[model samples]
Target: MTFLKISKAAVIGAGSWGSVLANVLVKNGLDIKIWTRESKQVTELNEQHTNHHYLPGLKYDERLVATDDLAAAVNGRQVILLVVPTVAIRSVSQKIGKILQTSNERPLIVHASKGLELGTHKRISEIIAEEIPEANRAGIVALSGPSHAEEVARQDITLITAASADVAAAKTVQKMFMNDFFRIYTNQDIIGVELGAAFKNIIALGAGALNGLGYGDDAKAALMTRGLAEISRLGVAMGAKPQTFIGLSGVGDLIVTCTSVHSRNWRAGNQLGQGVPLADVIKNMGMVIEGITTNKAAYELAQQRQIEMPITQAIYQVLYQGCDIKQAIANLMQREGRSE
Candidate 1:
């Protein structure tokens, strides 16, 4: 199918990922607007092409406008990228939906956030569907992979998948953001893409905990491999395509998240492993460490789906149940031998 042309794009969050994505969109010759809730941030972005609060070191394009007004951001746009935290996605989508419902033009919605809703256990796309009706939801897509906001903001070479049931919408987003530095591949399995993106953070925390305990590369490798297994098992059980777990959003993302210092989830787990309290860790991080909530959510989902996810369970106990980090590592090590 011929892709719909995406000339103007609105990013519905001014966080690191949103800013980076907006920059990429602008680089691809699309007019971009970055929406933030804070009026001061809008003013700051307008004056200085940098988002000091979330992404301090990077300077955004002068052409990218930042605004606090959601309606103005989404109105008359060809694409809307949702980059807010998982918990805030529903509220953001609801407001966007109301605005789009009143507008004459409806932009294709693309989600960049990567976490399942805690209470509803719905993916970001699912929440968008619930908030926006079927007709509006038809244009929804999810963009995810191993790409980090830090690297993407720096215009580093990165690849990601834009998945949607609607191939036309997926291709629209692919064409909207694909550039020399940023490559986008289209996939139809939105469920697998979203699940792989969300669940990898949980395993990354486990990998960080191993590193915190001064475990060697062998231990880290084992945790990472087993973690992928658990992720694949749960993802397949949850109706995701089995091969997606091995793709960019799955093992590829998990490796980057677990190994990179840029990963807030890994950093949080590292702190926890180093004997820091969860409250202290969070206070120090000063950002959304997705793994904390994802760990709990994954644990719940595993129970509901009857999937065995030992790494997630271990991290959940350490974070929420006050289980000792050392003991958690020990418990994971003591599990019975099984086939790889």
Candidate 2:
């Protein structure tokens, strides 16, 4: 199929991932507008051309502009990328929906955020669809995988996936963002892709906790591998294809998020394992650690699905039940043996 033409684009959320994707589009010669709730970010992007807080010391292209004008930034754009946190998806999409209500143009809506919504346990795409009018969107897409905004800011070679049931919509994003340093593969498994991306963060926290506890490489490896199994089990139960868990959005993302220093989720987990209060860990990080919230959501999801997720349960205990970290580890190690 011929890919959709995307000349004008608006990226909602001037966050690290949002900024990186906006910069990539600008490099590809697309006119892009980045929207942030903060007026300071607008000045920094327009005058300084940098988001120092998120991508420290990394300069952005002059062509990329940040705005607090949500209506102006979103109206008449061919593409609107939602890169906000999962929690903000609904509100942001509602704002976009209001702006889209005034126009007939249907922009291809895409999201780079990972994690399931807290109360509803909805996927980011599902939340977007709920708020945005169907007639105002060409199609919705989820862009996720192993790519981190910090690494992408430095032009690191990053591989990620763009998923949509609408093949043309996915291809449009793949063409718009794919470049030498960043490559995007197209996938039709939105369920698997979103789940893999969300579930991995939960595991990364566990992996980081192990690291913080001074566990050796063997322990981390065991956590990651077994964590993948737990993720796949619940993913399958949730109607995701089993194989998608082994693909770029699954094991690939798990490896990067669990081990990479740039992972806020991992860092947050590390702090938690070091005996820092969860609130303090979040406050000190100065960024959203998706896994922290995702852990709660995943724990609830596992129960709803009646799936066996000992790792998730253990981690949940440590975070919510005030279970000691050492006890959590000991409990995990003492579980009944099962076939691999």
Candidate 3:
């Protein structure tokens, strides 16, 4: 299938990752527009060239612009990037779908959000396909990996995966975003890529919780290793290539999110480990902790599939079931030895 040659793109969210992606597109010479709900944010981006709330102290490209109007954002764009939090994907896609119905264009749809839908257990691509009409969407791509917006904003060397069932669409995105500082690799396993991206957060939370509980690097390493194994198990069960977990979206992302200071999920887990209430931890975190909700969804998915994800189960119990962190860790450690 011949894909649309992307020139102008719309990034539908002005949060940290969305703003960073908009910058990447601008550097790639695409006419980029970022849509946000706040008029104040648009004013800040247009006049000051910064989004202080999300990406503080980082100056954005003057060529990159922001708008509150959804129609204005999507009207003639060749690619539409969905970068909102997981909870907002359906509502944003529904609004975009209605506006695109009248336009004579089909734009490549890429989502950078990482989390499954809570109730439906659907990936972001599935949610977008459900909300947007087939005629309006060129293809749904999952852009993921160990990319942190904080580092990307600094033009750090970041490698990411652009995965889609439609290889052409993934290639189109790879061409649009690749650069010296930012690299894009294409993968066909959208299921594995998306699942790896989502499920790794659960492990990151566990890592952070371990740190908060005064455990050293050895404990974090063990948790991340076991976490990846369970991640691969669940991904393979759901029709994802097992090796995808060992790639950028899986082990790579797990490493970054678990270790980086910029990881909100890690910070949240640390607070939980320190005995702070989940509500307080989330409240103090000015960002969306995708792991919290992803933990719930993954726990349910594991139960439904009968997958053995002990780390995910332990994290879920601590977060949702009011289980003590020490007891949870003890229970995990005391489990019968099994084959590696």
lDDT of each: 0.87, 0.91, 0.93
lDDT of 1 at 88: 95
Tens digits of per-residue lDDT, candidate 2, 121-176, equal: 98888999989999888899999899888888888999999999999999999999
Assess the local accuracy of residue 24 in candidate 3 as a C-alpha lDDT between 0 and 100.
Answer: 85
Supply the global lDDT for candidate 3. Answer: 0.93
Worst 10 residues of 1 by lDDT: 131-140
- lDDT-sorted candidate list, best first: 3, 2, 1
Clashing pairs in 1: none
Model 2 pairs in collision: none
TM-score of each: 0.97, 0.98, 0.98
Expressed as tens digits, the lDDT of each residue in 175-277 for candidate 1 is 8877888888899999999999999999888778778878889988888888999989998888899988888888888889999998998898888888889
Find the candidate with the highest lDDT and give its number: 3
